[model samples]
Target: MNRLNEQFEKYLLDNLPKSKSFHPHFEKALQQMLVAGGKRFRPLLVLSVTDALQPLLLRNALPVAYAIELLHTYSLIHDDLPVFDNADLRRGMPTLHKTYDEVTAILVGDALNTHAFFLLADAPLPADTKVEIVKELAREGGIEGMIIGQAIDCWFEKKKLALDELKFLHIHKTAKLIAASLKIGAIICNEKEIAKKLYDFGIDLGLLFQIQDDLIDALQDDTKAGKTTSNDENKNSFVNLLGIDGAMKSADELVEKLETGLEAFDTKLKNNLKKILNNYLYRHKNL
Candidate 1:
């Protein structure tokens, strides 16, 4: 699995480029951030959906997978900016704004945002399919999705939100892209029925993921988390609203809910998806 991850990372690195004589500083920062990898979890979902369906499908899904990762990284770079989270570290290294200048970080993030769509638009797939992919990405990553989620997050800081509102915030901010990743993969194979099922699965998985991330930030060390921790005091997080044990229990319930939803799909895909979610959740329990 790690080898597959390495190969996917290389694929992104190989494709990432700029004119040789063009501005190098911002481009260099973008490259460095991409190299300082995370779990590649978003891309993995795209690839895994295709792999579980059929390995050959990876060729069709790879570009979309890479685009999702690029878009996600773009969000991270901006999220860590001084005006946003002001995070100093990411992936165990100084954040883009910290390593480079804030100006460079902003531009690198802008470049990644536009570049992600360019990749999706250029993906080697049927024209109709490519168009749908682009639309899905925009819907998930744009104002109706991740962007709005961020706005809500910023607006709600230091203010308590209802549980449903909190779920809405995360479902759009964090889960939409993940849901889109799987949906895009299934669309590559024209598997709409299955895609919807996996999309729901992705949303549930994302909810669990954000909850775990919140718990980690509230309970773990920066050194262990590869980024700052104990920063959720005023943020809209599961920890603040649900408390630690309540958040854990809610996450477990979500896992069970997802498992039930997965039963609507093929048994094999359902089982594999559950196993992946379980593994990721299991590892974080220690964090």
Candidate 2:
């Protein structure tokens, strides 16, 4: 692992929401999902861009990376609610609702979601830069993006969406946030030209990620996945839509596109992306 990657785990651990309250377990519940380990994929995309483009700003970028992580964790918490996937496990641990109560889980997700913006607002970057970062995160992770996608997914369950529509659903729900992470890092580094380019690539990368996840869900058990598996039977997932063989073909085409896309960046960004993506690029095949 990259040393920065190692350091980020510690940084995230040290910076979780902390407080004293009359409500006993709320504090613990707030910190539960954050502490429960999952792949720190989104934040690392932000950090990698900043690290490659502007090492001097790497330390300053921690807040940016952390803000993305907080938003992502909050989404996971709410996503695992009884209304959504309702899975008992997440990141290999019992979900927040199961560990505590549904109300606690809901409130904790709310807290994390709100705190993400607060981090951006409180970051030490210039006013304009902070505004851009906040706007990008909001546009990608809010109603225009993740929320609408989730709404579509839940609303359209058991109803088959066309291939393009499924792509739209996952792109907004998953890809846009991933795209925002890369673009936000570029924004922080003041690399405006490449920011859009990275974001475009991130969209495809995130779609590939979702497909790979669907494949994992179809092929792996809960014990292997550390979360619920075979649960997308009614959901409009790629595995359910395209079947395993067709999904694998889609993943293959995406991997090729992403490889070509990675090569287009300057050496620093390309190599950085390659390093992060190597372990994950063809991961579905193994499954």
Candidate 3:
């Protein structure tokens, strides 16, 4: 995974979006969140799955991985906008809006969002495979997925949603994209038998990720979390809906479920998935 992260980072640097604009910082802002760094969770999922099933295709899969990162980073930029989370920090650095300006931040997010698909369109993969990758990305990260969840989240601030409703929000906002990452990798590798199963696992894994993030937001300060903390006080978060204790229990249950599910996968795929998830699978429990 370390090797993969290094390779992906190199790819990101090599393929950064280029522009020469009158504005001084447009291009820089567009690449800021991505280069500043985060967990790289979604892209790693794509790479890990690809590596496990078809090692020879790992290099070709980098573009798909990068596209997911671009899309994910765009979401973070928009999520930090004044009208949204209004967060000043992300990935351990000042958010684009804070470092530059709100307008710059907004436009950067839009550019990154559009460029995600552009990367897919320009990848070296075959036409049909690229189309399938595009479909998964669009379905999971588009209006039916993250956008609607973001809409619900912004609209329902300070209002308590039902437990199921909260799950729906996070599933759409977080899980769908993560699931799409895995499924897209399977599509890239022609592993149809395993794609749906990996996607299902990704949904639960993404929920677990959100739950853990909520726990971190509750317990860790900005310096520790590398982002704004205690920011979900008014939003529907796992730690808010379920107190810290209840949220911990929920995480525990998910950890057990995911571990059990891991056992069902073929040994090689299971090992590969486990390598990527070793410390992360139960991160909240340590808190």
Candidate 4:
């Protein structure tokens, strides 16, 4: 995973767009956000599934993986905007809107969003495959998915959300894109059934990830989290709604379910996934 992450980071740096006639500051702002470190988990999901199916095709899937990262980054930028979460920090640095002007941050997010589609469209894959990938991403990232989830999150601020409601909010906002990442890789390899199974697995994984994040925000400080803590105080989160212990229980159950889901895959793929889950669980043991 570390090696793959390094390779993906290099690919991103090499392929990211540069300003032509635009002001240097515009390019700088975009570059700054891109270089700011992140987990790059979504793109890794793309690579992982592709690696399992066809290692040779992993090269061809690079653009799609990068596209997911770009879209994820764009969402982060916007999510930290004053109009949204009003966050001041991200990845241990000032949020984009704080480092640059709000307008610059907004434009940078827009640019990244469009560039993600451009990368997907320009990838060296079949047109039909590209279209399918694009459709999945658009659906997951657009109003029907993440956007609506954001809307609900913001609109219901200060109001407690029920457990089911919280699940609905995150399944679309967080899980959908994650599920799409796996499905996109599966689609690229012509593994439709695997795509479906992976999508289901991704839903559980995404919810577990979100629950862990909520615990981090509630328990850890800013430095440990590498971002602002307590930002979800008034937002809907497993920690806020379910309490830390309950959220941990939920995460444990999800992990068990995710592990069980891996039974559908071959031994090699299942082992790879178990490694991922084990690493994650080990890292968050303190939580």
Candidate 5:
């Protein structure tokens, strides 16, 4: 896992947009956000799917993986803006808006968002395949998906959200992009059935992740989590909607469901995915 993360980081640096000398500050902001240490979970999903189906295609899948990371980074930048979450920290450092100006932060996010598509457009895949990949990403990351989820979250802040409503919010906001990562990788290999299965798996995995995040926020302080904690105090989170005990119960159920979903996969793939799920469980044992 460490080696895979190292390789992905190198590839990301190599493919990152070059900074113009005249616009050094603008480029610096973008670079800083990208370099801010993250788990690179989304890209790993893309690579893992490809590795399971066709390791030979991993080289060709690099661009797609990078594009997903770029898109995820853009969303983080925007999510931290003053008008949004007004977050001060991300990836254990000052957020883009806090490090730079609001305008710069916004443009950096815009650049990264559009540049993600640029990477996809320039990938070695066939035109039809590229189109499918682009359509999936755009729909998942756009209004029909993440945007709507964010809108609902902000629109209903400070209000109690029912369990189903909270699930709907997260399914679009967090799970869609995650599901896209897996689906895009399967699409790269032309495995439609596998893509759908991975999508289903990703949805459960994403929800589990979000629930764990809420638990962390409620239990840990900012120093422990490496970012602003308690930020969800006013937001509709699983920890808020469901009591901590209830959220923990939900997470256990999700883990069982996710494990069962992998039964149809080959042993190697199932083991690889189970490793990831177990890592998540280990990290949030308090839950």
Candidate 6:
């Protein structure tokens, strides 16, 4: 991993003060989920943008960055639950529901979801800034974003969809949060125009990302995936709509678009972010 990646990983694992001592159950689940290793890409994005804007971000960025992680982890927990994707494993370990129980998993996810905003609310940033971040997170992670996307995905199972429809579903379901992550981080830095650009970048980047994920799911072994593979067999995907060759072609085109989009930004920041994206693409067969 590169220096920025390593630092971001370390930041993700860094400890924080426990909020009082009233709730052990929720805290345990949150801590355990937080410790489980993953890319920590979203938080890295937030932190990196903050770094670009300011020399030091650990104090103001940590809580909000952590809020993003908690929300993400909560999404995974629910996504892995029996009712949704019925996934048993995540990040190469038993999912929250599988590790604990269905009810515990549900509560854990809920706790993370609610607590994420609480963290945001408690962030040391200015009140207006915190409000913007909170609103952005809620909008992206809530009904207008992931939830709706998930609904469309579930609704479209075993159903064929037009390319535009599929794109819309992916945009809402996955891309929005990514876009929001970039935008919110920029907002934290009080860079509105940059935030907007980051959000737009996120949209295209997210499309590329979800397409890669679909591709990986199509090709990878279940054990390697740590979750279901070919499970979206019934859902709309680039690999499902376009064949493997076509999917790869589309993904390459999207990557090109994403790169082109970054041309307007600071060369160094764009390069570093692209490096991270490249690492992801190279590590997975789908991209």
lDDT of 2 at 94: 92
* Predictions in order: lDDT: 0.83, 0.92, 0.91, 0.86, 0.87, 0.80
lDDT per residue (tens digit) for residues 60-138 in model 1: 6778888888899999999998888889889999998888789989988888889888888888888999888898989
lDDT of 4 by residue, 153-173 (tens): 889989998889999999888
TM-score of each: 0.94, 0.98, 0.98, 0.96, 0.96, 0.91
Off by over 4 Å in 3: none
Worst 10 residues of 5 by lDDT: 278-287
Q: In candidate 3, where is summed lDDT lowest over 10 consecutive residues? A: 16-25
lDDT ranking, high to low: 2, 3, 5, 4, 1, 6
Question: What stretches of model 4 exceed 4 Å from their correct place?
Answer: none
Model 6 alpha-carbon drift over 4 Å, by segment: 2-11, 14-27, 281-287
Tens-place lDDT per residue, model 5, 1-287, is 65556678889888777658686588889888778768888898888778778778888899999999999999999998999899898888898888888999999999999999999999999999999999999999999889999999999999889889999999998989998998998999999988998998888888988899999989998777877888898999999988898888898899888778889888766765665566685456753
lDDT top scorer:
2
Q: State the lDDT at 275 in candidate 2.
A: 78
Clashes per candidate, residues 3 or more apart or on different chains: 0, 0, 0, 0, 0, 0
Give the local distance difference test score of model 3: 0.91
lDDT (10s digit) by residue, model 3, range 247-280: 9999889989999999998887788788889869
Please name the candidate that would achieve the greatest TM-score relative to the true structure: 2
